[model samples]
Target: MDEKLSKLVQDRVGGAQPVCLFAYDLDRLTEHVRTVVASLPPRCRMFYAMKANSGERLLRALAPLVAGFEVASGGELAKARAVGGQIPVIFGGPAKTPAEIEQALRQDVTRLHAESVLELHRISEVATRLGRIAEVLLRVNLAGPFPTATLAMAGRPTQFGIAEELLPEAVDTARRLPGIRLAGFHLHSLSNNLSAPAHLELLDFYRRTVRQWEREFRLEVEVLNAGGGIGVNYADLDEQFDWAHFARGLPAVVDAFPEHCREIDFECGRYLVADCGRYVVEVLDIKRNHGVDFVLVRGGTHHFRLPVSWQHSHPFTVVPVEDWPSSAPRPELRDAAVTVVGELCTPKDVLAREAPVSRVRAGDVLVFSHAGAYGWEISHHDFLSHPHPEHVYYGDSA
Candidate 1:
């Protein structure tokens, strides 16, 4: 366990009481943001993807550091505005209600990504009603030899963006629309991509495609939103994305399209905030099921769903407890392979499965790191009416 995390668990957990806790080290988050921001090339613009972790405390911490926020819905846009007043916001999603479009237009978002021809028409309609010139970006679904990713949105018939073949029609329609000003293209295809070289290659492809489109269509592109897909190494910490190398290599990629003269936007989510948060849950029971050791905690998938989603053992460290007050005989596990499960009734509530731990007993805290992003918000919080975890923010007060 990290020394700071160990101390935090010790300080936060009470004797023999099973409580779920999420502690975020804001100082670490700020430093991570600074490192990423400083490493980027002059042409690269960073935007925090609000969908990953929309916690107000996290948003407040990131407000001053990021170029702006990339939101998917009206609520996220409102949240971004609430935390980062007047800061630029870009909206993108497959489904957008008329009301949402109206709100986005009223809010004067930096750019709105048109996922489909209908969405482009809707934006034009809404903007025309408001008598406002709406800056728009066509989200392109590339046809390829796609990069390897945990989730691939492009290079397939996904309900995400308009296909590359259909982009010409969309662009022509956009040019015809009186209320719409076509800015550029948004090519966000992958999710959780770990390789920096792969990302660089993707950017190079994006630049070439953008330049080709600009030339073929005789259009001026002001921005090329290369959509954020940077991955966090959850399985192995050492094999993390080489950000320093990526930063160093970005200039070459940017310089390749000198004729394009477009601002490259990175709307990163998980990579920015994952390291700064810890999910600390106290073990309620230690048992053996069919010769397999099971360490049951007070919380489960409802509180943190990433492990369940990935179906992999979440990386965690045991915070040993000195005192054990249970009158019942507690099962002892030492250097054992155990599956960490939550209080949920279903078997799918496992957090970490068949992992070797030094020692874990009742009242011991299992601290799961790299949970700052997609930890709380993506969870099914209201399920079974179980008590919620305490969201603790460390560092400066929010």
Candidate 2:
């Protein structure tokens, strides 16, 4: 564990049983985001994808460092604008209500990614009603001979963007629309991509495809959004996405892009905030059932669902607590591989399966690492009606 994080876990999050807490180091998050921002070239813009973790504190801290926030819904747009009103916001979603289109125009979004031709018509109708020319990007789901990522939005059957063959029709419709300007293309191909070299290749693909589109459509492309897919390695912390190497090689990809293109946007979410937060929970019970040691914690997938959702046993550390307020003997696991589970009734509430733990008592705490992104944001907090965990920030984030 990082020294500061260890200190935070020991000093701030320490408590008795039935404790579930989310501890965030805002200063570390700010520094990390600033470093990521500085590494980018002039033409490359970094937009924080708010879908990963849309906490107000996170938005407020990230609003200044990032180029803008890439929002997907009206609520996200409102949150981004409320945190940093002057910062640019780009909206993208498969389904955009007419009310949302009007809101995006009224709030002055930089670009709205049209997922389908019908969505283009929707934007045009709403824009005409508002008497505003809406700048839009036709999101493309490319036919790919591409790398296999954690999740495939493009090069596969997905409801994310428009199909490759339908682009021409969408372009013509956008041009003929009364209150719309086709800004450029949005090629958000993958999710949770870990390879830097492969990502560079992906960028090359985007540049070539966009260039071909500009030539065929006779349209001047301004912005090419190579959507956020950079990943965090939960299996091995040392093998995280090579952002430095990716940043170093990104300029070459951007330099070869169309001269008419103004900005190449990288709206990263997980890569920005995955290392700054932790899910700390207290041990509720320790048992050996059917020759398997199980350490049950107070919280479960309802509070932190990344482990089950990703189908991986998340890494964690056992922080031993010496205090025992109970009169009964304290049971402990010694040099044993224990399966860590949560308070949920279902057998699917496992966190780490058969993981080696030196020692874990009933009153100890388990600190889950790399939990900053998609931790609480993607969880079902109200399932089972259990108490929500406490959010403890090390620094003033909001």
Question: What are the lDDT figures for the candidates, one per model?
Answer: 0.89, 0.88
lDDT of 1 by residue, 1-398 (tens): 65666676777667445768888989899999999998888778999999999999999999899999999999999998898569899999999998999999899898899999998899999999999999999999999676899889899878999999998899999999889999899999999999999999999988888889988999888889999999988889889999988998999988777655668899999999999989989888898979999999988999999999877789998877877665777667999999999998899999998899988888888889899988787999988999998888887534
The local distance difference test score of model 2 is 0.88
Q: Which ten residues in a row have the lowest lDDT in candidate 1?
A: 10-19
For TM-score, the strongest prediction is: 1
- Clashes per prediction? 0, 0
Model 2, range 1-398, lDDT digits (tens) per residue? Answer: 56665676666434443668887888889999999999998789999999899988888888889999999999999998888677899999899999999999999998899999999999999999889999998999999977878899999899989999998899999999989998888999999999999999999988888888888988889989999999998888889888899889988888897677988899999999888889998888899999999999989899999898998889999887777788998889899999989888889988888888888998888999878899898998988898899887776553
The C-alpha stretches of model 1 lying farther than 4 A from their native spots are: 1-4, 15-17
**Cα RMSD to native, each candidate?**
1.4, 1.7
State which candidate has the highest lDDT. Answer: 1
RMSD of 1: 1.4
lDDT at 158 for candidate 2? 94
